[model samples]
Target chain A: MTEFIPPATRWHTLPSPFAMKRGGELRDARMAYETWGTLNAARDNAVLIVTGLSPDAHAASNEGNPEPGWWDAMVGPGKPIDTDRWFVICVNSLGSCKGSTGPASVNPATGTRYGLAFPELSVEDGANAAFEVVKSLGVDTLACLVGNSMGGMVALAYLLLHPDSARAHINISGSARALPFSIAIRSLQREAIRLDPNWNHGDYDDDTQYPEAGMRMARKLGVITYRSALEWDGRFGRVRLDSDRREDEEPFGLEFEVESYLEGHARRFVRHFDPNCYLYLSRSMDWFDLAEYGDGDVEAGLRRIRVDRALAIGVKTDILFPLQQQEEVADGLRAAGADTEFLPLPSPQGHDAFLVDIARFGPAVRNFLSSL
Target chain B: MTEFIPPATRWHTLPSPFAMKRGGELRDARMAYETWGTLNAARDNAVLIVTGLSPDAHAASNEGNPEPGWWDAMVGPGKPIDTDRWFVICVNSLGSCKGSTGPASVNPATGTRYGLAFPELSVEDGANAAFEVVKSLGVDTLACLVGNSMGGMVALAYLLLHPDSARAHINISGSARALPFSIAIRSLQREAIRLDPNWNHGDYDDDTQYPEAGMRMARKLGVITYRSALEWDGRFGRVRLDSDRREDEEPFGLEFEVESYLEGHARRFVRHFDPNCYLYLSRSMDWFDLAEYGDGDVEAGLRRIRVDRALAIGVKTDILFPLQQQEEVADGLRAAGADTEFLPLPSPQGHDAFLVDIARFGPAVRNFLSSL
Candidate 1:
């Protein structure tokens, strides 16, 4: 087995052009990932951490970047997904601008940005790419595969697409399929970008940030839906964002504290994320449906997932992937004769509870993996 | 009292330029109203029905417009409002475009469309304008005042601004104040309009619809949030809008029935509504705070509402004005010493339940008015 030395940042280019499951192909396809801790001699002590649509492979800070990772609280030397024991690899999703081959990448055919020419992407493709990453890392059998949000869906897709490839799987705040409600939300985000006159049919160039306004609005809706209104009301009930404004007066700037918070976060997101990449990734999410695995029978799809054990964790307040969807995952797996543990965590952050309230969400994940 | 004759459609201009309570004025301020049934010899028998945003005086079909009104299912000769027994008056809100003097009207000062030049608006201004319409009609006392959505907020404002003018008040899907959540939703809607390059700062005119795309996107979001996901899942459930497309493929045109539904409605709205009017009325809603009546005290706002009896009906699944806000209305009324009835109706229609599933939401209104 290869000596296990955790790498802070690494890139792997597929030997050949990567073909997509749905349609199209990515030439010069590359994968970016970050790892923590040391891999054991057995090559079995590896855990794959897949991310949501926006997060990069930098899930936790390392020597390369001293800054904390997105899941800094949950992944550390001694915390859940402990690096001291298992090698953890978080890979930037395919079709994402964050250090991965995406729409922003140059097309090998025309030597221009892919833009709208990017092929239809599916969660299965992301899953397959992740498997390639694992293989390149010399890990034959993963100790556990952990996914959150879009990552979770990809993890589930990996199980069904490559049956028996994983030892176990853990899906957090994810559903077997993207329900119509979610599809509608994602569709609006894409429409926001496409409708912008500045978007120029996604061929915006000259280093100009096209359709920033539309993207900002899209992120605003995203942030609002990410957290429950209960949390917003509790944290900011009509509290003014800027104290200098007259109490009864309305201004062009933001009024409520919540609006300011949403704007600030969206602004940051807009600066780092590319619009075309966002469109492709979002549409891929909407297209992801595991039922295709079982030929329309969800139970059959679950049966195809050959793992020693699996776990599905849901948050009660997660409207995106509600508890019922998570429950359906467990029920399907149990019906398929798989040893599955279903845990429901109550949180105020809605679909974002996994990332925000890690304290409450982590223990369930830690315990389930520990049990295995 | 004037003779009880239900006129078709009529317009009444205020004796003077109508000044807004918050600031700004409408030149040649006029209100359009349609009445049904016969006003009893005692003017006290008139019941005023104020409409939500985008609707006109055509609450129900009349001779001028033979088609069914937007609320045809809920109001008619023998419908819940029971036009046969009581004189029903539905008025176009102050800043709407259907018939009333609004942003679409020529500004007497500039001889141009008011557009953004129109003064800041408030729900109180809408209420006061409606009061003027009632006075011009020679109705001294009203049997009941019913308002839905933005109209509901105006009804509450009317009860307080013109204390005791309405004998009984009914607020459906309306709150004493716009919550932070609703404010955020409205803010995004306004941003959609403002961000549209074609919007031209709301100055586009001369028989052209300005910023139609932005309005369409805004309506898309509006339709999504106005109903419960459960309803969409039950009714549409990823059903293809066009079956000719490949089962696994995505199309540029709408693919899901829900998307088609929202687009159809938004298309119609775009054709009929003015963008500036939408901005004005939506901002008016955001600015309205019944607590302003009680000096920033919500309960005091309820107390300032000098009504003998009141009713607040909420949809169990309404996300726009959640049941909790509806409950607050009832609780405040009770604390204010009013004989109030709170009806928590269950429906999958959410905030639009009153307009969509009349069969389920009408009885509460009917029974309450009948009891009064």
Candidate 2:
């Protein structure tokens, strides 16, 4: 086993100008983020890893666990991201429960949680916040900016907005625009949260229940699309989780392993996630559209990207972010004369494949990083 | 347009035995059905068209309108089913509100709708009910049995239970086994109904609201899987139904065409379908397993089928009942030494493609019936 050392980190609040997607005057905003690796003398060895819907700036490794961050296995000293050689930065996205300025964050005016009063955040706003976070770190340009899922959309948005901020980009399991099915699924999830009596119109600070039931239901729905049917069948199937039978027991019960898996997912999500933040982030993801900035021409918007290299990775079984979608991103980058590589990861894990099957995804990412 | 005439139709009640899947058994069950066309002197012109979830015995062209039934375009006088020569019958399925013994039907013992107390039904029970309906028609054997979706499962179950009953079977957009994702989806839908405050433990009378919100939510969830992402994007890519927008309106609101489609479906379904019956029928579809009755050997179960011919139709864009699933059905029939034909219909309507694009499906089905 390799000996690991937890990195000493410092948090900073960067000023972020809130940009609206539907068209309006930009608003003043700020973001909270952290840096793990050291910036080089030339400030060119920077790698920015943007976060997903919920996670914060602690992407690679954190202080308490000593086991690295959520993507620690893929981003560490001599790891795929190679923290020893390059400086890595992660940001807690906008409209998240993390230290980022979100629904849970205190409003400057009211000194209370922004809650429902928080302005709707778009993916471009997240990208803008990330850009501010990088600027606060005194980095003029980035060697590579990596993001996954909604984070990937943020990275793409970063490229579209800044144009000359990053040399390379890695978009993993994300789409150029939110598909109709995705919008529909997210809408239902938002409805689930909205319908919860305890949600209190997003002002449930006094309610201890905090819309847990609705959040749990939303999480259950999320899990269904997060993983593929084949994976669920192979792992869970119709096998019963428990065989204990009692008198007067309900005859028709959940006798399937998949049900248990989904239940566990719901339980954990309800425990950790804030319903308001989930709603805001999901809406941010649904409203993500790079082409909207360029008058609906996706290719034209991509052509504005001045990145030297781009990497697009998609899971074959990912119905949500599908291989075809990643190909579109790669094609767009290629059309812009950027050196683009499209990697299709074969796995039955679907949208979760990027997070779960590291053995297959890690090596490909490492190879790509090394090449960069 | 061809001039059409209404046919004199006769209705009958057939005894349907109910065997609960979870535990308890229901005896002396009965099913209601209707028949059209004529039986030959040798009693060999029988053709069964199993109706889908919630539909009653009305499957073909009725008297008032000249147009055929739900499948009337393919089941009329000179249509695919050839009413002139074959005896056609459509049964209102068990656990449905279409003149059949369902949750809404009065229990002879209690003199009230079975409600939550209704015994859990399986596809086997549905097939048994259809068997009684067919037998009551005075036909010892059937020339062919045709079905779609849930009805298709019933047809397959009939083949599994009574191997020598039908000479041919046509299963449209059906699966050999319920997919795990489908099971998960159904489970969530059931949970939605059970969670609804107005559900009143499934005892809401016909005059009551009947958990409309829960039913609508369930339909919304169900509709997502019924169609493909491609179709959704093509039809409704974030186009708002309401043109006027206020400052406080939701950003990127249900502007997509697909949203309207889903809304229409949910409204229509909630108006026509019973919440408890939907739960029961969905459960029946989920619990359907041909191999379970044949000692866990699916191939062995298929080998036991004594059908002379089989035809399987799958929709290209159907994510719920994918083409691969239909192929599995066809493969099983072929393994049973039954002459089989598999046709994959290309349409954007997804699982509902068979119902929506009747013109194409009608011709294909008509040709197949002519050949038979």
Candidate 3:
């Protein structure tokens, strides 16, 4: 159990004895965040960005860290986010290992890693933590709140739980609730990790007994769903790996170029993300259902959100968070009387289009924020 | 490594020192098949049914086996194929655990299970073996060749390698070659099995060291892709399992009904199928490329097949073998001057629609065979 903190990360100590949504309390917890540009004197220029599952608070290169962040192409000074005009803040979700208080973080009282002892996580808890970060910064109301993937669920929760928290919202490929198909995929991922001998019920050490194979499998599955088959056909097709790149001795090893690509991609990710933290955060997403707030109606729950203006963007090819989900969020917000725009872009990259396909997403995001 | 043979399965010995496509030979090897009807006097009424990876040769109930088989609904008397009118023969794929000479079968010389020692299998190899059985049965291919899923690829190979083997073909939810998306998925499945500690590089015993966890994960992945998200949403939705059904002690245990369904489904499959056989059969599909026969052009390869008529059927919601792949198969066959009917069925069962969505699949298959 370990936390991978980026160089540009900053911390905000949460209120003492902060109660979790799922019935547990953290005595001395903290949130990890990073900022870009200057806050206006009126403090109305603050734009908070809640991230997907694995992204760190370091969304882009800052003064402290020159290395490019996950969304560097979209979050730079003059990028789609346009940090030069609006003060931008990105926070690592609560249960993530990227410099945030998570299973990888140590319990202050016991001075040991929380691991499986961490409270059952919920998307609401992450929303509340992000809310605390906003309040601590002395921002009464955010000018605009942006969320991508899992963050979309958290942002929805934040708006529902804390009325008038933000004047506007932009949800990118996020859903109002966890659908059975998505839940099944995430459940399989968690099962893969748990089945690993090295996982050892989340008691394994980071250095000696890391669940590398399980993590690799989970990451490969994620990669497969993240992109569309259309893109795969256009890119790798049925191309085979070169003889030199082939593992001849290993019978079931990489043969297709697509297999090799997944292997390389999964290997790069397995060690960087902590297994326990990944499990906690992933389960949190699976448990998220805005319908709970609406007496079991997802649209009704979204209607409860009080954002003045909103934009929900999704890719046509996305399987994990399909286009219909974003439409649901847009429809719900619109039904609540918020001026909303639902844009389903034709990006072959699928669920990961928001991160990789900047040509289409850049203008859509920039236009939304410019309007805000 | 023990093979699970069904009661009705009969054997046909391959020629001695049977050579594999990818440079290896099997001595005293045999294929397992079951017949539903007697061969007519002219021997032109034979309809050979090839299968997907896991199914046995017993595709329907008969005098020898009272048990209903995998495709019982569509293969029995007065059904889709109408066993009474057509001498229906279903052969267990060569590399499957279902009574076929696979990795689970014993090596004649070594006197032990072949496991990894089994020659690298190919869709073409299975096709050739099926051809041998057809020849041994004293049939001069006159009716139709029916293939579903992996069998579709094998059938295509069978047609390509053995010219004029069958007069007509009905390919259900199959591709001319392996696509990258399907390759990625099968790669992850094989990786899951390989990662299991008990798998021990395909040397594990049936009882104690069986790769239950690995096979469970693999089968779950298979099940997820076999059906559509639309079907899952309609069937399970967000229904959570009862507390009694969930393992509360296991943090990452089953939560949703979809998860529970998958767990049970996978458990039922893991023990019945051998892991090494699965690896071989799955890889065989990934290795199949119709383009290899025609200077890297799939359409050109399909043109070489001399079927008099062909039908390519696909479900719209199938992600593993998407509707487009079947369209490709149909288009290529049409170019080859065959009277082809490319029926893209609107079934929500995904890749496995042919197996479960009989209401839609039954008629399409019946019409195709009747026309033949």
Q: When superposed on Cα atoms, how far off is each prediction in RMSD?
A: 4.4, 4.7, 0.9
* Ranking, TM-score, top scorer first: 3, 1, 2
Shift in Å, residue B314, candidate 1 = 1.1
* Pick by TM-score: 1 or 3, better one: 3
Query: Which ten residues in a row are the worst by lDDT in model 1 chain B?
Result: B1-10
Question: Model 1 scores what on Cα lDDT?
Answer: 0.80
| Interface RMSD for each predicted structure | 1.9, 2.3, 0.7
Please give each candidate's TM-score. Answer: 0.94, 0.92, 0.99
Worst 10 residues of 2 chain B by lDDT: B1-10
DockQ of each: 0.54, 0.51, 0.89
Choose the strongest candidate by lDDT. 3
Instruction: Give the CAPRI rating of model 1.
Output: medium
Clashing pairs in 2: A60-A69, A61-A69, B60-B69, B61-B68, B61-B69, B69-B72, B236-B257, B239-B255, B239-B256, B240-B255
The predicted structure with the larger lDDT, 1 or 2, is: 1
TM-score of chain B of each: 0.94, 0.89, 0.99
Each model's fnat?
Answer: 0.55, 0.55, 0.90
Better of 2 and 3 by TM-score: 3
